[model samples]
Target: MSESSDGAKDPSAGTLYPGESPRVYRALFNIFPPYLFGGVRVRHIADDWTSVRVTYTVRPWNRNNPNRAAFGGTLYSMTDPFFGIMAYGQLGRDYRVWNTVGNIEFIAPGRGTVTAIMELSREQVDAIRDATRDGGKSITDHAAEIRDMQGNLVARASQKLYARRLRR
Candidate 1:
């Protein structure tokens, strides 16, 4: 892993900082105002950037008036960012990646803590690399589900991402 001038591992260096990267990112996300106030917490990020787990707690500040359930926006926000980050990290500095669009469908009211697990397979990474190898662009869709502590599905989300090789 590469270190910055200040001695902290440089996350943009396309290498894992062992146990540090995930913890650093998790801390950053947890303290981010939007996520902090919304009761969204990032629980884990795989060292290889293959998966992420996030939790959304239903709090008075983030509950819907109708039933004191988790707000739809908070649920959706919990599903955002992971896929793009995974793809970007897995694809490395040679490629450009972005989350072009996102959508969420509520299946049930989330009254307590809900979790979303996002995953990207090696096959998916290979496919994206193949599609963008010749300086071509590829648009792919990724999905995740938010489930309550009881393992009941509370929401489903999809993100459309765009990737292209950066000309060297």
Candidate 2:
């Protein structure tokens, strides 16, 4: 776990600082222990931390469901960390961010490998900054879709985040 080149700390479980290479954030995410055990791999992330793609393969340990489908818990868990992580990265060090709410709907049973992509657009980031610029906190909702290898939607999740600037 190296710090970003801009000397920005990744807020414990966070991403590289602005102007820092995307590779550093990717490396930190790839080696995350829960991701490794869950077979969830981050496929890509835009340099500005606006978007992230992740893939999860069902393994024997995680296939303990009665139908041998990917466990709903694992599906939910895979989407859990990305939002707050991304916000902290893009919002910079002067702010505090936390992934406060998560809800998932299992649309279809998932077998084999699956993928979920989480993205926070530049406009959205700007909105958050604007909403919180006065040091007031903001709570916002974000969504991600988890699809199976066949391009079928298996689950959808809504994650709400809390963000506010640290009062000096």
Candidate 3:
């Protein structure tokens, strides 16, 4: 397990919900209305909240009209939220974290299932914590690649997360 300078464990070593297991969280996230409707599923969330893997499928209802590929919005949605959640979990309850910006560039038409794996390294969590230690705000950028089952890149997504220590 990785530790921060302030002795906080790595993102993978912390839980978003105090007593809930990661598996349970993943299950709940999979059924979230937006994800369910968009054919996005949370396949796995690391035990410590450091990493997440999500899958988006191009079903008939979710496919684009002309190309019949995965919808761009859904692909972008699959890359959203995970980074902020990881940063918040690693930073603990005293800090606020939010995704400030998100962008996606489509590399190919996703005709089948595409997976997005998002991870926050211990170094990244520590950097965010250090940057906001004086209660000032910090923004960290993260990137993820959405890949098809055959390992072909389908899209590249980037997210900027803002973090600040909450004033007591």
Candidate 4:
């Protein structure tokens, strides 16, 4: 069994090479409805599933606010899928992971394009693995700060996911 950076066995490695399926998944997910409708674009998905970046562009129809800012809904929508998707990719099919909770805080009016970076560190992954090793589920929370082109904070989002090992 191949070991991940966190020293957990890669349960799906026998079928898919590292980063193979998820790369395709990331590509296809970019055009999915929530992202397409919100004018959100995925900038990148790192090979190891450690980092994913998303960008949102302000479009005319989506902006009706006084300042013509990017809709807060769009900002929130751009972040909706990352945590769940990343968890599935990282944990593979051997682990059942679901995004159980979510929330967003608008920090400022967003104009032009904004980016959100979601990262899952090895330490965090390891902690989750430890928590779920006893066959019970674990809830893990991840957060990201969305920033404007000028690197100013535009929003803060948190996602909580439930993960547990699957039985054959």
Candidates' TM-scores? 0.86, 0.84, 0.89, 0.86
lDDT, each prediction: 0.84, 0.79, 0.85, 0.78
For every candidate, C-alpha RMSD to the true structure in Å: 6.1, 5.7, 2.8, 3.1
- Residue 108 in model 4: shift from native, Å? 0.7
Backbone clashes, candidate 3: 1
Model 2 segments beyond 4 Å from truth? 1-21
Instruction: Report the error of model 1 at residue 91, Å.
Output: 1.1
Candidate number with greatest TM-score: 3
lDDT of 4 at 61: 66
Cand. 4 TM to true fold: 0.86
The digit string of per-residue lDDT tens for model 3 on 32-146 reads 9999888999988887778999999888888997999999999998978889877776777677889888899999999789999999987898788689878789998899999
Residue-by-residue lDDT tens digits, candidate 1, 69-142 = 99888898987888878887777666788899999999999988999999997679778877976779989999
Candidate 1 wrong stretches, greater than 4 Å: 1-20
User: What TM-score does candidate 2 get on C-alpha atoms?
Assistant: 0.84
Tens-place lDDT per residue, model 2, 1-168, is: 223336664353233455455577667767988777778788887777778888889977877568888888888877787787778777777778888788999999888999999988766766777788677889999999999988999999898899997786
> In angstroms, what RMSD does candidate 2 have relative to the true structure?
5.7
Arranged by TM-score with the best first, the candidates are: 3, 1, 4, 2
Lowest lDDT 10-mer window, candidate 4?
13-22
